[model samples]
Target chain A: MPNLYQEVIFWALFAITVFSALLVVGQRDMFRSALALIVTFLAIAGIFAQMNAEFLAVAQVLIYVGAVSVLVIFAVMFTKDMPHSTRSTNLQPVSIVVVGLLFIALSWAIFQSQWNEMPAELPVFVESTLVDSSSQLGTAIIRDYVMAFETVGVLLLAAVVGALALVRDK
Target chain B: MLERYLLLSVILFCIGLYGALSRRNIIAVLICTELMLNGVNVALVAFSRYSTPAFMRLTSVDASDSVKVLDGQAFAIFVVVVAAAEVALGLALVIALIRSRNTTDVTEINLMGN
Candidate 1:
């Protein structure tokens, strides 16, 4: 029961995500690249919504777009001429070869793996009671992944403390 | 549908890898890593959506059927949180490097004298 409207929207978001990712990598201007990355984050968040991940969509927007990208930009400001960041670097040729080979190898392995099949009853999850938002997710977090969740929070706190300690005037 | 999402994920991942490897700017590399993390995240969430038995049996009235519903999504959230922590620390390191070395270029940050 997929409609043309949904397909169009999906493709549009897909294009935005891919295009902005390319921009994030290829653009020399750091601020421009950060903006492109924000676009990519927003597009991916839209894709999450398209896939019926309402909670994740919101989290993606809040964390990636709102928090991470802004942090990147602020960090960019700490360096002068960082916006215009000239010089592509000497590693690019080696990087191209490495990344291309990795892509080929990964694609081959994935294609070889027979786990590409979706469930027979394929959940489009439009009206399912399991809208599966933050409530269920919170339950799962505090239940199944409780340790990981708490560890991550602790890790974030440590990172904050370590950063302050590291950047202090000596 | 799953294939398409995974394909997109692979492409996104490779692009991030390229960026991380090719960019001399430490900030660019950090951003690229975020891109790569997002790529993994898409795959996880897509699996949670389309491949999980919970989603398949979503309409079942059994109470336990909802337990592992979006484990992938939960894992993705964890990844996102960790990535944020990583970026914070990484950027701090970059700032510290700039303060010490007076440059943002990765090639120039040589601590060990050769």
Candidate 2:
């Protein structure tokens, strides 16, 4: 069983994440939606920490909050216009029904499934003082997942080039 | 605890789905997609923490005998990398769309659909 502080913090982060994610989807102002997205990302990072993924939590803050949200806010600024109350499509009702159904089915599956979980006493990487989690992650990337690592690097380079090409003046 | 995290993931994913399907603004669509990715990331990390075995450090005469598995977190890192690259390119495309069409509304920019 998790400690009391862990449960409290987890619930708090969960509420914040869900609320801000809703704001991101529902806000009328695009700028405010982007801001709410930032909040959602931050809260998710906190949840990552609760899951004992400190490295992922840091990367979440740096990549999602730092880079992605900043880029999105810049896009919002570039496309700013007169505020409109309506941002939803004519398909809003249909989308709501579909998403609601999806949510129900997923939650049902989650509750019904029997996952093969590790023993409760198994130490999470960050909690184990004997080994460095980040270093282990790095070694796995270089040694075990070197092909995937190189592929991701190439993918990023291609994305960068493609984006520049797309945005350059005609 | 696993169920709680999974439930949270589904909720966020569903909300993002609704937004992506219903939002008229293209940037809003992009933002919703990011939310979906984050939802997946949460599930990934939760499983990583709860489902996977603990880190085992084996010592042999050759140090290369040691084995470490952080597969879920590594996959999550790749997901983050892909998401970052995708968002960069996506925002660039949004900017270019704004430059050419002068509007960010997806409904108004349906030039390709017959």
DockQ of candidate 2 is 0.61
lDDT of 1 by residue, B1-114 (tens): 676677778889999999998897889999999999999999898877666453344455455446565787898998989998898888889888877777888777667855
**Candidate 2, A49-131: lDDT as tens digits:** 77767788899999989999889988888777723337579899999899988998999999999976756776443345214
lDDT of 1: 0.83
Candidate 2: how many backbone clashes? 0
Q: Which runs in model 2 stand beyond 4 Å of their true positions?
A: A82-85, A123-131, B53-69
- Per-residue lDDT value at A51 in model 1: 77
Evaluated at residue A157, the lDDT of candidate 1 is 92
Judged by DockQ cut-offs, the docking class of candidate 2 is medium
For every candidate in turn, the CA RMSD to the true structure comes to 3.1, 3.2
When summed lDDT is taken over every stretch of 10 residues in candidate 2 chain B, the lowest stretch is B58-67
- What are the chain B TM-scores of all models? 0.87, 0.83
Error of 2 at A75 (Å): 0.7
